[model samples]
Target: MRLRRALLVSCAALALAASALAQGWLDRVPPEIHGEVPARAPAGEPLTVRFSASEPVAYTLAYGGETWEAVVQNLFVLRVRPGEHALVVTATDGAGNETRVAYTVTGVGAPAAELHVTERARAGDPVSVRVTLPEPPAEVVSVRLGGEALPTFAADAVEGGAGRSVVALGAVPLSAAGTLDVEVVVRDPFGRERTLKRALEVAAEARPVQELGLTPEALGALSDENREAEAAALREAYRGAAPDPLWREPFILPTEGVNTSAFGLPRRYAVSGAVSFHQGADIAAPQGTPIVATNDGVVLLTGFYPIKGGLTVIDHGGGVSSLYFHQAVMVVTPGQRVRRGERIGEVGSTGLATGPHLHWEMRVNAVPTDPLAWVGRLLP
Candidate 1:
């Protein structure tokens, strides 16, 4: 009995020691959020810290004299001053055991304006210019493009502490070419002033919608059942969440014609007070107009879709894509390679359309943006 008791005591003591040793203090907190600073981040932007652990626990993080807490599977967004800083996150389990990890923070200034140009946009292509601010309160106290005050943001009052702002530049007119100047007026947090100017090269090209064809019968069918099928196909093609840092490059209009419907304009489909936002621009061109590829890309889909009629989807690099719909003919097939200005199909009012017009649309990483913004001067 004495021997058995001694053995039991020894086993218990060993087990307790092993349990204490297994409670890894260092392993409690992850190394990434606790250790090194990210290589790049916008200056004065919020610092997002992710805390993850297998066990359910609460955590308290401290950085730059600010303390924050995170519940299980929760993230904390913290703001830090510019330059280098330190961060620490502590985790306490249900047993009151605590562990901590530390990290460094390095601040970087916002990205400078880059000249985004495209070779395919023609005179009537819809365009949009958006400027992203580097810090919160992303409001532009003052802004200008080409010595002209661009009407992008609301100029009435500033809200939050938006230290940053974005101004979307409008489109150039059809047949507009030459050097366009862009200027931006900025006011800093201390009420200081700064100006940014850039000269852009505008190359003129003929839009392809000039050759698209349409018929009245095709238009009637397009405005009916075909419309729903086309929308469903598009939604299916983009089933998952979109990629980050969507394409910001200039886009070339896919078809050529006089723009009939404008982007962001309200469309009253019925006289009974039903209205919807115009998502894309409609180019009123002749039937059988040859649709052209807007940029260099590979064909993602090609088939006689239920709603799109004959549709061709081209995937441009960097998660950017352009879709040509309601074609009278499908010249390209799925998985085909195409270059800018290449022939894809002839436009028709095959699917759901009110008339024989080419419905042109542009998407950046699946987000709908103004197509004319890439095509030259639509906005004066």
Candidate 2:
């Protein structure tokens, strides 16, 4: 009889515990809330709304008497009409417990932005895009020309204004011609996006060419086997598009010689078949003439090659690089830090050259431009 009484008391305790567990289930598990209030939107513009919950939830997102429902709430966007409106996000769990989040949306004037191109870019010429933002900063700014993504770099504004970003659209080809279109994409902090299109008329100009008499034997002797790999390596090494000018001062010529040849004139090496551009100014100099650094930079490449001969490449940063080829002897090592007017090598005709001349080339983002343009001035 005592045993039976004890068993009955234990059963009663279990029933009470199960009753309390059933009653407290809703209190134990509740909906969680996260995410920020969106930025200001334009009048009559759609306001983008986003929020998150810990679990699957039923949500009622309301703004100005207009309501939207989400059976499962994680990421969603809702458009609301412009003007000041209170946005209420109510998330309910399976147990009917609700978590409410509120934010004030003040729809003011649309966020203003503009794009300015510094110059009319030629084919194979470097182009820059500058964007100006509204008083309230945007979350992100993007630019594109000819349907290609242009990488942008942020910079401080000159004359003390809002921040600006400069994107270096490296060396577009003549193929991107005619009515060129630049697409600017801007997104505010509130997930509202504004797209603007700017049309630029590009001029059609043919790249110049030159003819050279080179025998087939001479051309084949220039190590044609590894030429592509070497060229690719050099291009990859100097492909950086830095925002700030790596060179603080104007560039000075490396050697004392008359410019016998200029950049961009593609030399037809064979009678009718092979054509390659002369990327540098071929300045006639003595084989032992000292070759100096054009400006302050890090020596990225220094070695003898079949085409460039004894070559030395100095990276002046900001996508500007200088190349001195056909050196008799290289004084500096690769990765060496060099200064303006410092002797880095001696001019020579060690590789595919007619005589002793320093082939000095100035490249911006690996596209060869006139070295003289960069000499005695600040430029690409």
Candidate 3:
């Protein structure tokens, strides 16, 4: 209720309310108390109660052992569990006379909910979250990422594992690297919920949303001239990662070689004097050596691009993708499904490359991850 009331004289001694009524405020027509109790809803559906009176009055609302009084009439949204609920509304007029009303509603059942997701991610990466409940199915209420609310349409549920598991899935884009926090609200048919809390350490720069207290280095870091264009392309590429994981086993090295360039290596470009972080692991391999798909996935992109020459991207689903760059030749075409260890390209020095090498990278939400970390293990 948004009741902003003004201070007024008591006028109790004058019996002002009685006199005003005697003056015939309601003589021509009876006063009206308008609005209705919302109909019953299935668990997880929203519950709202709205009311209004023809004239200004004091109103009190009672539900679940709690009573609320307001100076003006308004709407109320209740976040209670499913079942039958009674609502009591009391209104008092200027004359000190009062009226009380009651309403009841039934709510359906929903599945129990608990959050399942990774605990760490970088900015520009995707944060995948799931609500897991028992087979019967439950409705999702709300989802929040980094304290921002996402629209309800963002959630999708899949019933699997012999109807023993119901998984509600959703994700939010993370552009501010550092800490990733997520919350999910799920309700059962009877209005019960299991809340999930997730926190992940993002292997990225700290982007302070509030600038007032930012350090000079932090400010300089956020002022990236290439941020706009790069962010857009990365976001589009990351879209492929939102689906369920398609890979059946751990990732494999694209070529028979050792890592020569480790991920997260900071470097200064001798030509541009620009500083940036290396996003992938470079494996030293002879030119024309076969490069394979790390896991099962559909080739999302192939062919040349700036920085990453002979580029090929495979979306492995589960918000994860693998990138092979600096290849001598790209044999895979866009949109082709490939299997693990399938040769998709040949190793080469391409796109700002210094020598013949395979620059292999893994991304989750388009955020660069440790390629080796996924070599033989399913992602958490």
Candidate 4:
């Protein structure tokens, strides 16, 4: 009986020993970490490091005298000074098995400058192009869209004020329907020249056509000399733009009236069979309706003309200008500062028109755009 009892005890001990050995083997396998640390990063900028483990793990990251602990699923972000750094990570699994990883990261200066532009725009729409650099450039040599120079101004950078931003305003031509190339040339503070390039895709816009009949007096006013003179005056008014924006709020409508003629409409005169696209919107109102300034700006020009009648041109700065035409009386004069919604004129049919109305127009960098788009909104 004693021998049989001893044999049972020995068998039980062997079974317990086998179970212990199996558990030890399973605990020896540590969790595997999967990820890569960037060898180089932008100096002083936040660098994000993402990693995962084969199994759930508690991870600890050590660098630059700082320690961070979280689950392996969470990402690690660090901002290292402009130099080399040693990053060490330790991961521990549920079974007490641990794994360690180390990486060497180098922090470098800012990357090459970049140019940003609107990727897509509709024909006759305004587009904004921007150039970003680590430091402000000494001079912006030129900003060109489709090989034409554009007016540029300084603006706040998009990257949390870490760099400088130069902005240029442009418009897609009413007839353009393809990709347009943009080029920017700037001189760095060190006097080194840098050129950046980008492309903008312009979509076609289909505008409606309108036919109208004009009296002999109106037809006579549309002479070649009158048109050329009006064109020259407008060019001179838009030649010098303020380096900054003057409007402090959203733009408003110049007057309240029915929109008789929309912008970009092909107007065909029945009297002479002449066609021309309307550069502005015609708002029909009673004679002597109050007209207000679209935004805060300086009155650049106010005078009577053959085509525009009592016209007032306001420079809202930053390549934006507003025009109010066909007015019976002009309340503002050149070099006078006007505020948004302030009275500037009275509606009339003094110009080449069939009835009393106000022809309101808005231009960006000398390019006529849809004025209604600017109403109730602020632009860059």
Candidate 5:
């Protein structure tokens, strides 16, 4: 009789537990919103929306005066329209419990122009590229021309609220006629919505500059031995690999002196009016003038040369490098560490220079950019 009583007690406990489990099932499941959809309209060109949820929920999405019954909440993408939109989401649990939430949709402006890219000019020639937009967004993050991503530019009040950026290729040779594709991306401040796409076209080639040749007699002035040694030194200085960071610090002037020649200046040598371009700036200073390092850098080169005189080149972490020419003496040797403003040399005309001065050149990925624009503004 006692055994029968114990058996009855166990059966009663199991039934009670089953009833409790069914009652508390909803408590274990929390509210989830996973489905995402583009709040912007299809007129915005690149707008898309997405959606997600924890489990299958009987739901409906209301937008643009239309309702969509959502059998299962996975990912639903929508192309929306311009102007304000009301989003109503209704969800019902398996147990018949129901919930709803609302959000707003702000339409994106139409593309003012397709992202357009054309060869404006050539290296050493003036290049102009035109970008057309259907309707300009409030701001432009950046426009990629060719294969390069340039700085973000802002629009003026008159530019249809669209912005532009221009670059000078300057004296660099191209492998061949090139095709360029431009990509422009605009973002809406709300909801981190962004539109990105590319525009492609063949670039119009600029007229090639005629090459001026000098006879062997004219080149006799420079000693072949001296020129070979100088070439070897420069090659050694540049052959090593350097990292090109995604972001770079603004350049700084290595030293202060009188600016004698600006970059890209057409020049006539020996009163013949035979033109040449000044590739770097000449900063004339007194002999023994302290030549400081431009930024924190490692000395890649410290040597004397027949063409450059006594020169030093500093590799500043990034692909950026600075060259200081016409030094009377070099204080730092190759492989030495130097800080910004650290004296690396004394200025003197040692190479093919007219006077005591420092020829300073700033190179980005081996390409020359405007040094003044980087040096003039005091760094923050």
Candidate 6:
């Protein structure tokens, strides 16, 4: 009996020791928090705050008189009004240990914006205006050059950098010379607005004149109604542009051919003695020669028209577009995405052409600009 009693006592002692060891192994330290949050955030916009803890934890965040609870592994987002805010966060571990942190965040007003443009530009030259802001804007209201609205799109802050800026594109008309005003208006996330303005000096350059002979039948084929219809269709296409830039590299020549006519040249029809300025560069090539897209873009329009023949227009984003006219056949359809140098059509004299050729044109906000100037360089 005594031996059994001693054995029971020894078993009781071993159980107590195991219980003590288990209690000593329980976690007791609170999680250590680490990460960063923006000292200043845009008013009325969601601001992402990121942080991590040394161990698994559930946290409650308090900001702008509101509280949010979550099992956060990395980050959280909150919106604050225009003013200073005190952000407090409390973390709890599985062992019931707690860690608390506090931070001060300032909600800023409308962001300041600046306009970038060249002080001087030449007639018929493509003009690009860049607007830089401290933060991404809610919307770009308007970009105007000489009282005319331009095509605007979102662009990278710098080449090969993060996209955080807006770019406006237009051309100085052939008749425009002297000083021109540039204006830009933008809205912030909180509905706040800001405006920027600048000036550009335009210079005129003389162009050569050429005479062309066309038969009366060919000249009278297109009526005034047909011409107006085509013009209206083109205007609609130019007004709707993709919100972002599509091309990463500089534009390329659409085809390999001999240049027969230059852009912005005065052309007088010999049969009727009617005068008009050439809007595109004419390249004489053999019929069935392959034509390629100048840059990456979405096909905006492709159809046969009274004046353009088998035409294809590609929207290169940023209010920039390229046109290929007088093609024998168009291979791409509207809404199709095309890459740079991809074949889009074949060269031919389909519309009002004296010979087989391709008429290449580039427009900034529907204003004709020099296509050759964009061939090898990135426009500002």
Question: Model 6: number of clashes?
Answer: 0
Backbone Cα, N, C clashes tallied per candidate: 52, 0, 14, 0, 20, 0
TM-score for predicted model 4 compared with the true structure: 0.66
RMSD of each: 16.1, 9.1, 15.9, 16.0, 10.4, 10.2
Identify the candidate with maximal lDDT: 6
lDDT of 4: 0.80
Off by over 4 Å in 1: 1-229, 239-250, 376-380
Task: Estimate, for each residue in 182-294, the C-alpha lDDT of model 2 and write its tens digit.
Answer: 88888766566788787776666676667667667667756666587569768776654344555667789999987887765667877676667666788999889999999
The local lDDT score (0 to 100) that residue 178 gets in candidate 3 is: 58
Model 6 worst lDDT run, 10 consecutive residues: 20-29
Better of 2 and 3 by lDDT: 2
Against the hidden reference, what TM-scores do the models get?
Answer: 0.41, 0.65, 0.55, 0.66, 0.50, 0.66
lDDT of 6 by residue, 218-312 (tens): 67745687789888888777666675678888899999999999888888866448778888889999999999999999998999987788899
10 residues in a row with least lDDT, candidate 5: 167-176
Q: After superposition, how far is residue 74 of candidate 4 from its true place, in Å?
A: 52
User: Where in model 6 is the C-alpha error above 4 Å?
Assistant: 1-111, 118-120, 135-140, 157-160, 186-194, 235-241
lDDT of 4 by residue, 153-222 (tens): 7765222344477778887777676788889887744345668788788776677668888777688898
lDDT sort, best first:
6, 4, 2, 3, 5, 1
- lDDT of model 4 at residue 349? 85
What is the C-alpha lDDT profile of model 3 across 231-258, one tens digit per residue? 5565676665536667667678889876
Q: Which should have the higher TM-score, number 2 or number 5?
A: 2
TM-score of predicted structure 1: 0.41
Residue 217 of model 4 has an lDDT of 69
